[model samples]
Target: MKRFMLTWVLFILCAGTANLSLAQSTVYTPATDLTLVGKVLPTQQVYHRVDTADHPDMPPAVKRLLTNSAGLAVAFKTNSTTISAKWCTSPRTTLSNMTAIAYEGLDLYIKKDGRWQFAGVGRPNGDCTEYTLVRNMAEGEKECLLYLPLYDETTSLEIGVAAGATLQPLNDPFQKRILMYGSSILQGASASRPGMAYPARMSRAAGLNFLNLGLSGSAKMEKAVADMITTIPADAFVLDCVPNSSPDEIRERTAYLVNTIRQHHPKAPIIVIPSTVRENGAFDQEVGKRVQAQNEQIKQEVAKLQRSGVKDLYLLSYPRQLGEDHEGTVDGSHPNDLGFDRMLQQLQPQLLKILRKCDLAGR
Candidate 1:
């Protein structure tokens, strides 16, 4: 009986050891050996959309589906321990479901050499697509990998988390925050990689934390959605929805979208953007003209509110000039890379003006 009991004990120990080994092999490799004693925590995260419905200025089915919270993330450590983790997702394609219309299989990238490089791809649920587990050092400052994609097409990608760092909060308390609400271009389509999108670029350039709420085709200023926007604390809010909606819808919802954010961020500045370049060549130029008209309407509304004593409302004027694809867009309606640049260039100064206000407001 004693021998049998001993044999059972040995078996149990061996089995446990084997199981642990297997588990260790399957998770993300730790980037550091720093003491990580605290619980793994979730930092700032946004839940917004990118839309392109009002842009009759847009041609057919082209759309970008970027999200505001799609920026950088870092992991923190509490003890000197090695952790193994892996990420999973459901569908690799963008055509998953309704929510996917906003966020699909986009991964975050790391910025290196003044350009963003692909880090790890985003996974949905337990369907982890095996990315090599990289190690990181968290010195409690919460530095994790930036989840943005490379904007410059020629940059090389990097993997592995850094050491002694914690994840950057989606909402930086110190830096000014900019909230971008727009269509798929803001949503990050065909940018060659994640984080390469225009909104992401703007975030990096302006040195501000970004909240991208770019739904692919869902920028209709629904009261419910607008109500959701009110919950976030933003230094400023941007509304760009010409690729998804019609003129009437644009006129109707633009005020509501701006006003909703304004209601919550009463003192926060609001900048409304006219639609970017569209397809259909010169024929589609009319869409740009209509967008200009819509801008006029929005401006008038702001003026009315200003008369009521409201303050700090502005507009971004996008030219009807041809996008990179003078024939108008790579995927029929959406702007190509060159188009994104044009849009970004036009937006930079306007964004700077608003950010300046953010600094003064101390958000």
Candidate 2:
């Protein structure tokens, strides 16, 4: 009896050791070695959509949000049976309306059938976290895109895989880069994860790389910010700034914003999308009037620009940007994932139509 008990204990220990050996952490490639997509500037900073050092004069809010990895992702190919990640993010007060995963988490997509599909998500723990993202996959080479946190600054990231699996960089799929400048919605305020942001979704679906430059509530289109935006040589420009701007600000700043970009781009198309009808406008008469006023004023400005020979300028709109049922928003202001999906349904085709005219439509 004593000999049998000792043998059973020894067997348990060996099994535990085998399990540990099966998932060792020896093969991690630092993110610096990978190709980072969805950035507005060429900087090696881990998840910066915009580089603050170059735009010292930008608003403090805009400067801080620049670090948010709204639309940034790392492209790589691996044949690992399991994909894992180790990453550290900045300390932040958890947002009340947003999910912890969406605020500061990693979203993974695997390419299959020539389309990117959501494979897994790296759920964040704290300032630093490590976890196996996906497992139980059949052995085969696969292309992968790992999206960084939407609202937090990622300090470091390392992709890990099973031992002996080959890991290599994948090419940036979207060839035409469009600079997406707007408010918190574009910065991905309430997306369930980073990839659900309208710009990120559009990139995967439309074949145009939309770099997120969302400034939260700070996309007021100041001339200083306009100058900074012009510095990035984007293939196209998208101005979704009206939601955060007042009717007066839109009237005063719209021409400056469009003209400054035109001075730099000359022919690169500029697509201006006015704010959606705030959901609250259904009841609040004053809110309804304000949104209408802003929309009408911006339309006039677009007409003036077109008359002045602003070629390839388009004013894109949808009757129900959120939805006909008015059920798409999270807080009657920002989009939930459903809200974003509904908006993308209309936005994707309208944008491609404008891009088609400029001979810059698809990848």
Candidate 3:
């Protein structure tokens, strides 16, 4: 009788193991059909260079946003409170003391015009939170749903929240996706907060979904990287890492990367964004002019490819209006909050044009 009981116990254990494996294999259901969902900025303490600034710094949040292999979630924190924040009509960021996490993903809610609805959500694998909603851009109340378990020690925490647009979940009748490749800036440098980053902002503005593959200080345009980019089913891809590459390197890699992506997404539009806010120009030499020139060359080559039957292609020049001289970045290389805004201001129009073209092309 004891032997029979042991055999039954083993069978039950095996069945449980099989069930767990099946559960793990389940793919995360994106709130939207598009892959390029907008990102939300997590809250943290402000880490300012100085104490006597116009802004009054706060302590870090009780619960912190985790940093993965990527060096994100590190740029905005003060001691505790996230320094990157948008000013409300009043002057208060929200407190983020509680935490939750769904094993698969998390959902966001917005109380706009006095109705609560699903705003947007993040993918479980990529470590991105703060989703962009599909609704119109107006004023509203936004809240995040934490999926992961919160630290028991964490208490009420403060977070910087942007008050411009509401985020809603995307539901797709058909599955389509977009991918973006770029540098640290794309990874989100000095954007007041994570959600405030231009890519995240642009994703919201454009109403398209995307996968952000931005690498901080690591956009080498290597063939291996290009090879990896070809493996995805992206409807569109943006190459904006040239600022970090040298002239010759940009010239050499542009065609290869374009061709590589083209091999997979033949009809998808590939937009090339030049470097923004660099070279420390005195408004004379246009120090960033070199990078700008490289972008132009890439644009021309893309044109040439189109003539050779490459389906959809586009170019976004660095607008002279948003030069580094105007805001003068804090590090002379990376843009501070002001510089980021200026860069975004320049990129926004160009981005709109390209996205509109994409929509027209039926992507």
Task: Report RMSD (Å) for each prediction in the order shown.
Answer: 11.1, 4.4, 18.0
TM-score of each: 0.61, 0.92, 0.53
Q: Provide the lDDT at 87 for model 1.
A: 34
Which candidate's lDDT is highest? 2
Per-residue accuracy of model 3 over 229-296 as CA lDDT, tens digit each: 67666677888777666777777777788888988777778887777655365454666577567566
Q: Which lDDT value does model 3 have at 50? A: 14
Give the poorly placed runs of model 1, Cα more than 4 Å off.
Answer: 1-85, 95-127, 132-144, 148-174, 284-296, 299-308, 319-328, 360-363
Q: For residues 252-311, could you state the per-residue lDDT of candidate 1 as single tens digits?
A: 776677767777898788777766654553477776576566566656665676677667
Window of ten residues with lowest summed lDDT in model 3: 81-90
lDDT of 2 by residue, 291-361 (tens): 88989988999999999988888999875678778888877778898888888888878898888778888
lDDT of 1 at 184: 65
Candidate 2, after superposition: displacement of residue 172 in Å?
0.7
lDDT of 3: 0.47
lDDT comparing candidate 1 with the true structure: 0.50
CA lDDT of 176 in candidate 3? 35
Runs in model 3 lying further than 4 Å from the true structure: 1-176, 279-293, 296-300, 321-325, 360-363
